[model samples]
Target: MKRTRVALALAPFVLLTGCGGLSGGPPSAAPGTNAPPTVPRTATVTVTVSPSTPSASASPGSPGESKLGPPTSTREVTVRRTTDNPPLVLGVRFAKHDGFDRVVIDLSGGRPGYSAHWVPKLVQDGSGDPIDAPGGAYLQVTVTPANAHGETGSPTWVGGPVFHAGLGNVRSVVKTGDFEAVVGVGIVLDHRAAFRILEQRDPQRLVVDVAH
Candidate 1:
């Protein structure tokens, strides 16, 4: 009877093995049980920045108006001859600054008396030949008691009768003459405008500023 009972108990297990119900594997959750906890996913994001560009029609002192100055007028100016002090012409130079164009005449020995005036046309000092000054207006600059040649008759300032300045306002400088202990410089302007003359010491220089 014990062997008969043992066979009956082993019968259900043998039947479960035939049906593949006891395969060795991990246990699954019950129908109503919560699923295994899932790890949260993370995402990354990036951002970019761009620079701003300036536009046209922007007002002065604005971003787009950088590196530029306001326009100025060109009025007539003159400096009369005071004393006859002979100065030797050393060199000439030009510069563009602020609201004007500057022409500098370097001198040595002594500062000479000068006369600066606007003229309808530029003419040679002794020759009276019409100077081909390339500008709408002309400034006649005369330096007295000055010479382009030294006492030994050697040239101090020797160059062409016409010098191309090509500055802001002054276009050309014409060497009119070095006659009668006087030196003449003709300034050609792009347009007829206001101008001023200044004399500075310490090495002595004649400065001509024309409005741009």
Candidate 2:
């Protein structure tokens, strides 16, 4: 536990007049009061994403959990740049929901910025343990329809959600013309409602409600 360069970058869709949820969340600061963590400085990128259809399914969470659902169309999303760190490029997005298919990641710029929490890796069928976080050095992932190209809609980004399936998960290294990013989503869904992080006054987001 000493790999904190902290940077998971992805920037493209920063309007925020008010965007509540899609599993892509970030907005809420109060209770214990939050917001005071933004650091970055490093660089690397060569990511890409193109979509249509391919794979989904991951069932593990009971040691530390994260689940959020509701998004039935949004494929092809990638962004990368990592190696020695701090240019902050690691954006990732994929959506589809009839049962499952959602992956969104964004860690931006650097100086010690962007730090998501969750760790445990290796599971593409080898069987078990899949969820990772490295620096906190930002993001790194690989998720497919689940069992290797199961679902089909055509377009193809090599299985839609797998982390390095064809490159493209939103990128970083800070040079999208200099800063202005937002992401605050914390989901855990499969039914059983109870996901909340609402702090209004001037902040609006972080909402995951699933239970049907």
Candidate 3:
């Protein structure tokens, strides 16, 4: 009976030692010490692109944007009848500007009626003779009630049928005819382009401007 009581006392001591060993024996660090270092995660990013806007000077019909202007007037333009206001052709001058070439016709008496058009080939006034105007394109300018002569039948405009203009766009100027109260002036261009005509008075001038 004494041996059985001693065995029961030792059994409780053995059970306590086994429970301590199962709890990792002893702690390597204190409780609530330095926590595990937090690892940072990389974030994803997104980007977007948009088209740029045009400036205020960006016009559709600007000279820098287009190489050529609008088409010139195709139909005939006449100021007055051929019999009215006979004017004498005094001189012819040529000028070169930024993007155009100009031809100025000086008159003595008054402004005369004229017809200007693009022609496939420029011919003489009276005789059906072909004028060898030096250019890739030709403009036939005819002024009515006008003459390149004075009252005594002297040649006022002292130039030939073919005159070398050598301007920006105008290659040459040809006097196709001056017959029967009509004066003909041919403009030869380096290339086909748009042109405009203007009439100025006081000294009575006819102006032709061709785009380069």
Which residue pairs come into collision in candidate 1? 74-193, 74-194, 75-193, 75-194, 86-145
Off by over 4 Å in 1: 1-85
Put down candidate 3 lDDT per residue, 1-212, tens digits, no spaces: 45554434432111110111112222235467876433221111121212232112212333321233323422323334333347789878887866878788888765466767678888999897998886899988887778998778898888788989898789998888889898999999998776655555565677676767
Q: Model 3: what TM-score?
A: 0.62
Quote the positional error of residue 152 for candidate 2 in Å.
38
Cα lDDT tens digits for candidate 2, 1-212:
77868787887422111122234433345558577423222211232222322211111221111344432211212223222223222343434433433343333322111222212322222233442321112222221111111135221123222232211222121111111222222222222221111111111111111222
Provide TM-scores for the models.
0.61, 0.18, 0.62
What's the count of clashing pairs in each model shown?
5, 46, 0
Tell me the TM-score of model 2: 0.18
Q: Write the per-residue lDDT of candidate 1 for residues 158-191, one digit (tens) a residue.
A: 8868989887778888888889888888889888
Best by lDDT: 3
Error of 2 at 92 (Å): 2.8
On TM-score, the leading prediction is 3
lDDT score for residue 35 of model 1: 88
Candidate 1 TM-score, true structure as reference: 0.61
Return the lDDT, model 1, position 11: 29
